[model samples]
Target: MAELWKSLPSWVRNIVVPVLVLVLAWNLVWFVVGVVSSLLGLLIKGLVVVGLAAAVVVLVKKAAKS
Candidate 1:
């Protein structure tokens, strides 16, 4: 790998490699952000469902007492 890199032209090593690295890093950052956003959305939905279920249970108990 070192030999292959060394064989590449200096221009490629300096310019092309850094550009590719930046592009890949940008994609990786967005990918992580998307995953976190999706997980958070799911978490919020789950919390809403749980809250609604609890509310229903409480209402039912209250009605039963009445």
Candidate 2:
């Protein structure tokens, strides 16, 4: 593997290799961001649902007390 890499031309080694690495890295970063964004969205939705449920319970208890 090392031998093959070393055998590559200077332009390929210096330019093509770094460009490919950057592209791969950029894709990976976006993938991670997408995953995290989805998770956060779900979390926020879950919290909102829980909050609404709690509010309903509180309101029902107050009405029953009356």
Candidate 3:
């Protein structure tokens, strides 16, 4: 194993390191965007549900008072 590692060319190592780093950075960015968008969607849906529930309660109270 040590010999295999030792035999790897310096040029290959230099190229591979930057390529791997870019791939990792891209994946991290993708994950963050996915998480943020999903959270935003959930928040919007929750707000809509809460608004509808409040409207229903208001209508029911008004009907009962009449």
Candidate 4:
């Protein structure tokens, strides 16, 4: 791999490689952000459902006691 790189022209080594790396990094970052946001949204939805269920249960218990 090092030999192949060394054989490439100076312009390719300096400019093209770095540009490709930057593009790859940018895509990787966006992919991570999308995955995390999706998981967080699911978690928030789950919490809301749990909270509503709990509230309903508490209200029903109070009404029964009265």
Question: What does candidate 3's lDDT look like per residue over 1-66, in tens digits?
Answer: 878767889876689868988999999999999999999999999999999999999999999999
Q: Which sections of candidate 4 miss by over 4 Å?
A: none
Residue 33 in model 1: lDDT: 100
Note the Cα lDDT for every prediction shown: 1.00, 1.00, 0.93, 1.00
Candidate 4 residue pairs in backbone clash: none
Question: Candidate 2 overall Cα lDDT vs. reference?
Answer: 1.00
Q: After superposition, how far is residue 62 of candidate 3 from its true place, in Å?
A: 1.5
TM-scores across all candidates? 0.92, 0.90, 0.78, 0.84
Candidate 4 least-lDDT 10 residues: 1-10
Per-residue alpha-carbon lDDT of candidate 4 for residues 1-66, written as tens digits (9 for 90 to 100): 999999999999999999999999999999999999999999999999999999999999999999
Error of 2 at 17 (Å): 0.7
**Candidate 2 lDDT over residue span 24-66, tens digit each:** 9999999999999999999999999999999999999999999
Give the lowest summed-lDDT range of ten residues in model 2: 1-10
- Candidate 1 residues 12-64, lDDT tens each? 99999999999999999999999999999999999999999999999999999
